[model samples]
Target chain A: MKKAIQYTTLLFTCAFALGACEKSELVDYNQPDMIYVFKDFDSDVKDSASYSFAIKDESLQYDTVFVPVRIMGTAKDFDREVKWAPVDSLTTAVAGTDYEILPAKVPAGAFSANIPVKVLRNTAMKTNEVRLMVEIRQSKDFAPGISDANGSSWYMPGASRRYLVKINDFLTKPNNWDSFLKFFFDTFSQVKYAFIIKVTGRSEFPSGSTGLPYAQFVYYETVCRNALAEYEAANGPLIDEFGNRVTF
Target chain B: MFTSIKYLCGITLAIAMAGCYKDEGNYDYNEINKIAITSDSTDVVVSQQDTLRINVNLSQTMPDASGLTYQWVLYPTGTAQTRRTLSETKNLSAFITEAPGSYVLDYFVTDKKTGVSFQKRFWINVVSAFGEGWMVLEEVNGATDIGLVTKGNKIYRNIYSATNKGAKLPAGANMIQIINYRSDQEIYIFSPNDMIQVNYIDFLKIKRFDEFFFTAPEPKPQGHYLLGGADKILYNNGQVFPVSLMTPPPFFYGLPLIGENPYYMEPYPIYSVLKGKFFYDRISQRFYRAGPYDIELSSCPAYNPALDAFDMNNIGKKMLYAEHNVTDQHIALFKNNNHDSLFIYVLDAGIDNAAIGKYDVTKVPGLLGADHYMMSKTLTYLYYSNGNKVYKLDILAQTSTLLYTFPAGAQVADMKLYLNYDDFEDPDNYRVMGIATNEGDQGKLYYFHIAGTGNFTGNTYREVFSGFGKLSSILFKSRS
Candidate 1:
């Protein structure tokens, strides 16, 4: 009975090992579920033309690398088209300029390799979350049917955060609401607000549960009206979807 | 065990390989620099003139050198001298003055590569002296039209022939220009043959307009001093005789050698004059002008001798008047009783209406602009008109009177008076005739006779010359 049990255990073990070692299309290495490091890059994209990353070296020198970046947020939701490419040769980059990316071999303790991916100007990334899928691979192995056997890695290319560019005391970025409120309050002076009140003549909407002060709400309404007036004075007024003047 | 080990090795190897990639980039380029000029040079020099040499140089800081050209110019000190280009190279040199005086020089330089230009100027004085005098002024004997000047100073017609041809007068000798009324020329001297034996005790002196030839104390070279008028004679006695009558006989005529187209009369009486150094008046303070210069002269009251004298209101501190001789078609000004001053009037029949005028006695000499003033249109003489009616005008009184009526179609377009001293028109003797331009303004000379009371006497007339172009200002020069 012991002999029969031993044989049976060996057979089962063999079956389990076979199942674990299944060669299904070379383990489908491409299906590693690409993790785009630049997924949130376009949230406050300052410049869509250039982006960079670091790499540990004494490694394979790649002629080119593929960085898959997707624009998320409203732009991606609508499937807006965007340009994607690897950074140009490093020799062409200016040293001190912030816009260019400088790549170097791992010097000492930390190994860093920057894989810069750029979006051409005409096809700039819109104001939205950009999901970048970047893979560092040897130029020779970059074929349609073959994947890099010994040279491929994923990385995020940017400051790894979002920021707003201040211009003329006004925030140039945060092309959305969340950061817009921060910029508005930070820049507005007391006298400027008072002047706004005198110019726009408007009160607040009735409060529901928020219990915000009526005067504060009134100020916001006036601010909106004044902003619209200033915009009209500069670039003309806005028209409704029906082609009629849009009154506040 | 072998299968598990192989699979583990494959997965681990893939992970290690994926993290191996390098970037080999080296960036370098050339630097950029630009060039520019910071300052321009002002140097120049003129020839022979003792003025210092002035040169023009450019002050610039440039990076690259390529197409650059320089130029210099010399202009006379006054605005009348148009600026001219002298050079196309950097040889900007000019003499400020041949001697001691002022001159203007301008320099310009241009960069061909960048198309940038620079310019500068300097006023320099050279060490040299001008000639002993500014210019020499002399009389052209026998030339009839000698533009006379005294030590380069333009002597106005203030003195006529007050003495003999070779005679010199005291520095401040008082004199008057004896204008011959007929030929429109001043009589520099009276011919000896034309002199007549008149009553020495009853010498005539011209004191006022109404009173001609008044009795005055005459002595000491009386012949050379008197403002004499000549008349041809007839042999009534054994010797030649002159008609004692105030009006000369047919042979005895008055010379009309003052001016052609009676000063301040004709197409229109337009007058203009310079009141100050730069002030110019073209119109008689009536028309509104939309131009660079808006000069208007206030027309004050006329000079009236009848009221015993002029009221203070009639006299302007800086004043001018347009006395129109409607019958003569000539315009003239009596500048502070200096009637023969260089303050002549010019009509504007061209662009800008610039009065072609020259100042009388200013240090800064140049021609100014002026116009004519039309007072009244009337025939001051009697008889000889298309309508056969003689017209007369009293300007100060502002009255137009008809002296005589004439037949139809004898249109008297122009009534011109002539001073016929020698009466070149008459063969036997001299006769001062009234030249009239009639019917379409055609000119004709007539033997005009008006009574002492401004009445018509000899209306019967004859026509002389024709086809004259409105007879512009005529300057008559006779055989002295």
Candidate 2:
């Protein structure tokens, strides 16, 4: 009777330990540390000349996470020059996996690129999340002659851009794959609005000596409240953030 | 919910089944050909070979055949004649010469399929033309106006008259009278005073200018929009635009027939060009395009009896006449009558009797007192009357010649030189056809012969008719 009781107790203890171990194995130690920032946030324009963005992923100090940033810019003219900063944004983007940007033929001046990164897991903490702030500026064209110490900053005429930062880890529980995936999908799915303004004026020829009468300055402003209105009308409804319904 | 699902599933299944079903609605008999024939006419007489052309229209009413072929057969007037098969039915003209007999043409058609046929028949005729005929001209009973002329088959009312303002004769009226020269087809003549009020609308239709639409010529180089064009009516803020094209509504200038709708007048006026210049009448004021004209608006003062030239001042008194003078800057009336005698001279040195009489140019008391003096003169002969008789004063001889005594029971309507006479030998040898209607119970015609025998020896008179109507002016149809 005494032996039977001791064996039963041992078996109960082993079962409970096994359950705890399984729970621990399921925990996700990887934390997202990717961030994307657009330099021209409020002044961002739609269908304007293209420009560049700066994407940073501080994942080396956090955990193993895919720090993929998508660079998006639009312009009215189909073929307006939009050279990217760090000019080789094209060759750097992953063709199929981490950042699968498409239209197999890369356009002449697309300012989209990716940086492959391997994050180092945090030693002291089991999980940690980091942010990467990227600055995006639009340009009608690029002037390699102009230089700035911080990533060689330059502008194209009539260029506009916006900054968008995405946080990877902002949750109470670490092993939330569903929530993490939802956030990842929601970043691109939200509807974005952009505004564009054009300024024009006429003056005397720079080379002439006589005083010349000049026409009044003209400014044209248009607000693209939601870029998705026309798109939604044409193509039923677009998938929105995390199963949220939106017509765009 | 489950029932709805089942219903949707059932409906989908039914649709699928229906797709498998063959469309048998179109699986009926085929109509290979539809043959129809029409004649220029239906019946005819013998001895005339009417060549009826058979038009064989080839069509395949059946959907099975890609194309069709036609087969024609001639029947009833059987194979006893030569050249019967009309050129092997290749959608070409088949010449079937019909002879002097009653005949029926039978036609047939066929398709590529073995079981398709259509047939039909038509009737024809051949006869001789009709010949010439005669007509009678009768006067309308009470009106005494010229009545009617019957020609061939249609009878046309005689509208001829002596006054120019009266009805104009038909275009072929003179030809009908002269060429036929048949006494049975006599035309009745009406006096000027016997004029009837002709309906203006019917008269316009007779004149062939009743209804017409004017197509404006292509607009000029520029600024033609001011004249006429398609315009968009628009309101400024709220008020409406007030521009309008104003003109009088059209009407006629004649009398109406019995049971005719009197209000069916022409609604638009046509523009007329006179003497190389345009003239437009609003049915009220006469507008001269490049000249002067007298005009009266709709809102004019009271009618004055003696008001001349559209003025309303001078009433119950003798009025002066003033025509627009081109060379002179003043009114130029040669004469005026103040209750009695009128004498007038004009720039045109010719005899227009109506202008002279209406303008009161001659010394004749018009239409009133008969104890009056009347005078008329040409270059050589002078005519003057002093209450008793008319005397022909020879201007060359400076002596008066007693022409003719005014016959009793006669009222002179008009006197003019005999336009029908070919020649004259002396100053007194002139011939005049006088229009006179007897003032007695029955009017009469007196043919007076004024001979130049110096002592009135050739003044023989013939009383033609005692109860004759008014003697209207005699117009020569042909001088030759």
Candidate 3:
């Protein structure tokens, strides 16, 4: 009788202990509202972006560049101003002359917004590139969020608080000149590229998904070839900057 | 300890016994009705715009036919298998609007009660009504229209205007060509400053001048040629634009063929089986060739003076006509810049050792003054027309034979040999020469049977077609 009572007590204890264990739930934290520059999830770079006016038309005097920013909290019913300014110490461009920071706001019920920076085409950009470093500032509605230096393993950060852009008007060989343009334009040379620009009346030759159809490149090839032939016939062989004969 | 272990074992046994206890739940089961579908024919052949009717005989194990829904669907057999619903009735009676090709027809019967569907499949071959014939391009009432001469010699005049809602093509339309590449059977009408692509089967206008290119060039269409159904070359204003039709539609012509040196190619393109495509550069007075898969044009390599009859790099004459003759030999007629001297240069179409022979035909009677020229694909003979007379010049013998003369008032407008690149075994292929004449607005066409020796069989026309308006060109529309 005594052993039966002891076993009954032990069985009850095991049942009670097993029933007390429960799955853990995550609790939301009450934190301050904050914002940061959103980074492309697939990109390895954390804080920089570059643009060249050489790929744009010569007639374009000013162009707007957008930087994406995301909030760390829930969206609100009312719009919120996103505070951002150029870091003077790291910036090589003059604010009023080289670029202008437009007003930016995250609209109501939206978690993200684009900070527009209108970059101007200055004559000095033709020979040298201009750099601008921007950072988020504390505002009335929100505070600066997680940054690369403050990020933890559980919450990795990107260019969350700061970003940089390099702008230039100097001509450089396009990224797709060999894979796509070479079939039509043969080889890339500064002289040939300049001649192509003059004959086609365009400066940009975009590649990748947004690239022009192959047929258009073929037209440029023919036009450039004919123009080069005429130019040579009137003058002599077209000599490039490297003292090489230019041919299509 | 022994007592506690015994009590725990008893509890565990009680729990295991509870898991073995079973409960009876209320449920039901039933068998589904089996359906069987049958048709008289599983293989069908129909033409475009024709009705396709098929009676389906379906039976169910349980007599609940009223609850069954029917659907018929048709889709092409090519890579783009876009299914189109044909009918919802038990019997299919739908008109096929698909292009000429193979297709699949499916009959689906679904039972509402069981939510089950039974299907029957069929294979369909769709043909075009205007599949094969001769298309005659003519200038009627100051505008261009097309006429069709069926294999049975049935004439359908003003077919283009009738099919296109009375919209007429521009005047001075000089060429009508059919490009039957892969699944594309397109007809193009070429005028001086305009060009239009029409449906090969219905002659309905499909595209206009600016639609043929991504960036439309000057509208000076010289000619359009196909290189063995692989590449299409379009010549406009002395520029050559080539596009590969080996892929699917939405094809646009790319830029002209560029070389290390500048060149202006004549309209004639000679495609050799082994040597890709050849073009005569009018500016440099030389020959340039693009390989089978090449986009750029390259000049022919230097040749030996003793072996080669003429230098391909420096012909120094204007190309009047260039086309492929018998076997691999291509015959080109050249005239001096002054238009006084005429010569015939015969060469193999291949790149190496291209020159075979050259002949001075400036002294041949009525040869230099000929307006139209066509080379025999089976023999070494050149057929040309001067005034109302058509002469057959024997290229081997260097002699000219007067074949036939039209009426005194008749003027030869155009001449073409009945050649079908798609159907070489066609009954009239290379055996009949069609000549169009204009005798004071009363246009007439004649078909002369060619003899084995490259002459007219009876020195006369075998068939004569009239009621045409000043024909400019005629081409055989072949069906694949």
Task: Name the candidate that leads on TM-score.
Answer: 3
lDDT (C-alpha, whole model) for all candidates: 0.30, 0.28, 0.82
* TM-score of every candidate relative to the true structure: 0.17, 0.22, 0.66
Best by DockQ: 3
List fnat per candidate, in order.
Answer: 0.00, 0.00, 0.25
lDDT of 1 by residue, B176-256 (tens): 123443432222221212222211111122122111111111211102211113321121111111112222222221111
- Of 1 and 3, the candidate ahead on DockQ is 3
TM-score of chain A of 1: 0.22
Q: Per-residue lDDT tens digits of candidate 3, residues B248-268?
A: 344687567777677789898
Q: Sort every candidate by TM-score, greatest first.
A: 3, 2, 1
lDDT per residue for candidate 1 within A149-244, as digits (tens), equals 222232433322121111111112223323333222233332333333344442112232333332233234335554655767887865533455
- Model with the higher lDDT, candidate 2 or 3: 3
| Candidate 2 residue lDDT tens string, B1-480 | 445544555565575467679877886784444434343433423222223454544444344544445554443344545324443463425444543334544455545566455655544332211111111122232233222211123222333342234544332221112111211111222222111222211212121212210111121111001112111111111111111122121111111111111111111111112211111222222212111111111122343435323222111223222222112111212222355543221221111111111233343323232322122322333343333334553423445565555566455433323222222343322333332343444433334444443222355343333433333322212111
Docking class of 3: incorrect
